[model samples]
Target: MRGRPAALLLAALLTTPAGAATLPSASILSGTCCPGTLWTPDSRSLLFLDGPPARASTGIYSVPAGGGAVTRRFSSVAFYSPDLRWAVRPGTGDATTLERLADGRRFTLPTRGADVVWSSSEARVAYARSDTTGNFDRRTTRVFVANVFGAPRQVATVYGGGPTAWLSEQTLLMSGKASASARDRTLFALNVQTGARTTLRSALGFRSVASSPDGKRVVYTVAFDSAARNGLWLQSTAGGAPRELNAFGSYRWRDARKLLLIPLQTDGGPHVLRQYDVGTGAWTTPGDLGDQVRQGDWNVSPDGTRLSYLSARDGNVRVLRLP
Candidate 1:
């Protein structure tokens, strides 16, 4: 009888493990309507580019995050401003067109085929024009900024990777080499108005750079640089010593202070959602999806309440209510 009671206790413990990491999710779309999908600024719907064979014509489409009938948002595709206020369409040559969605007012920029990164208010923009010929890491790239309807002005030059993200209205966070033959790349911030630069971090190479929503902090990954240099790091844009996160994987800012990450564990098990609180300097594994995210196709909503991802099992989009 005592052995039977012990077995029953073991069964209960197995059924309800402590802090089990499984999270339930629902599908938002099926049949692979699009590959790279983006969430709307409001986080109510997802936007994707699609065309005939499945859709009627080549354009931008949107579907609600709650799952509903699909609808067309824009007739033609363009690199849209985050606020959906402007559509930037690059042409075959040096000129790119910017159209205001409200009044249909238009202007052109000499951005070549590169997309312009818009400022927080969508009032100013920055872009890079790189030398077409030469080894990619050695080629010189000129960064430019222009006000809406204003002429483009050359600001700075960096070799290799150019402007990665706009930290603020007048500052740009970039990574590149000092010279073509330089062994290491430097991640620096540039003030477009004052022409000032602040060196943040230096390494052999950097990947997956991202800025916080408020533009006060940045996170990035440095891999294959050496055992000590590899992993994810968080630093302030205002200049401070960097704080390295203990974990590594795909990450996105859930808000100005919280970051969500899915560890790069390819064990064919459920994908886990780990949250890092920048303010408290704490880490917690809130939950895990019972599926794999396809090709890192996952994003946190603008409000940081929900998450959406492409399911690897069925090749469809799924939405999860973050725990």
Candidate 2:
């Protein structure tokens, strides 16, 4: 029964949970939905760029945590505030736009052509600038820091890469290719206060590096080949060899003690979402929530209590809630 394909058995399992309460039914916001790229700090709202005509006309939509109409569409992509009061519009082009949700006041950021990230407190913004080219060009990517409404400050001149993550109030994590071959990527933790750069990881073919919420651990996926059968690894922020977990595919740290993993079979299909107990080295399926939904991205909340995944069922993208 467990060996059945996803498309055949997914709907039947939607109402059945092996051990927990039945998962929530999903609602479709539009005729089409893309895999979301950003999840809010509280893990309650999801922001994704929907495309059909292909241009800046792509809009962003937000759905409730318990599920409802996905309101609030914007001409540009949206990044929610830490308090969910406003959304910082890191523009897709030369201009930067910030939108206030309460009164709908829009502000333009002074910096031109940069990648932006918000501070932990949401009172400051950090950014990096890169050459706007569509070629095999070599250019220096520099990091900068600024208040949410003030002038920009140059923090560091990172040669090849852009900003990655903020380690502390003054430290940041950045990465770039080690050589022109584009085969090797390295991770570094840069201290803004002391101008010290620390190498974190230098795996040969690593990608999707994520810092934990507590900022003490990092989880990333390393692919052995282009086929994408990668191993999920967790390492400490203090630096050490990463410990590889048993299951493979996409993974997220639900908390420090547990991890959520989607184990993919050889045919490139996810079979189940499994929770890994770090202390006992035990892997348990949360519940038999039925078949895996195709074309859906799964996310576990920051508190590690709920799992939200978007799947294509009956030709529409429906968001599902798991136990």
Candidate 3:
């Protein structure tokens, strides 16, 4: 589970046809490229964040499918963009701002803090505002939506500590606290236009949620034990029982047929990038990229032909391509 032997297995997988064709060798960015989140809109470009710690100094960067220069789109703290063109960078002090990459335009929006999310069309941004008094017991959090440069519109008031995902142009998928103990979290689908909401999942204890490429399915991880053992599950958007997928790792749908999963060893170390066949429910062991790199980030190219991920070798974070 540790050291050279594990690395060798990874290398063997890389030499195989399926591993090599899915991920191609590529160049690394100038600095450490730790992918915070990955987004693939097409086959040509991949967008992700490279930085240290959440809520710290970080920015968004994009690299080509073949891998070359990592373009720094914006500076300071920012969140992911829907269309990958604009990022919401909350300013210091009294006002919050949205930064547009098209023309480098920065506009002030009415928001106390930025938990910004882009509309499905990437034409608007939504965020949450919270008021916490010194008492710590009295607090209020509300969600709002606004055009990229227009005024803010109130959506709904939600409790603290939950994640949100856009299901479609008119609906939002949110994980809300369902109990006072905070042990249970419920998934809710809210319609932005009608203000109607419905529950998707309840008491699931899931930590991460990712929507499929077609927006018809969702993949998420939930802890199964107190020792931090976890499992991955897939649920349909139509709201039925979740089907558990046995592989242990964070995964993303490469297309409608395949999933890019990063396996976790029993010793709590990451193994390699594994491709899971959604149709057959089988895992293809990942190949290695020789001694200079170990493990690729589970990110597929926008076109679905190649997989690119951050590789750490010789004490550096290098961008490695597998194809």
- TM-scores of all candidate predictions against the true structure: 0.92, 0.71, 0.71
Q: What digit string (tens of lDDT, one per residue) describes model 2 on residues 228-260?
A: 234566777777776766344567778877777
Instruction: Flag regions of model 1 displaced more than 4 Å.
Output: 1-18
Which candidate number has the best TM-score? 1
lDDT of 2 at 91: 55
At residue 225, what lDDT does model 2 achieve?
A: 47
Give Cα distance to truth, residue 262, candidate 2, Å: 1.1
Per-residue lDDT tens digits of candidate 3, residues 189-208? 77878998877666536666
Question: What does the lDDT read for residue 109 in candidate 3?
Answer: 74
After superposition, candidate 3 runs with Cα above 4 Å error:
1-24, 30-82, 103-107, 131-140, 179-183, 224-230, 266-270, 279-282, 286-298, 315-323
Better of 1 and 2 by lDDT: 1
Query: Candidate 1: deviation at residue 70, Å?
Result: 0.8
For every candidate in turn, the CA RMSD to the true structure comes to 7.4, 7.1, 7.2
Please report the TM-score between candidate 1 and the true structure: 0.92
Residues 30-109, candidate 1, lDDT per residue (tens digit)?
Answer: 88877788889989999999888878888899989888988999997788999899999998789999999999999999
Q: What is the model-wide C-alpha lDDT for candidate 2?
A: 0.62
Candidate 2: how many backbone clashes?
0
Candidate 2 matches the true fold with a TM-score of: 0.71
Error of 2 at 265 (Å): 3.3
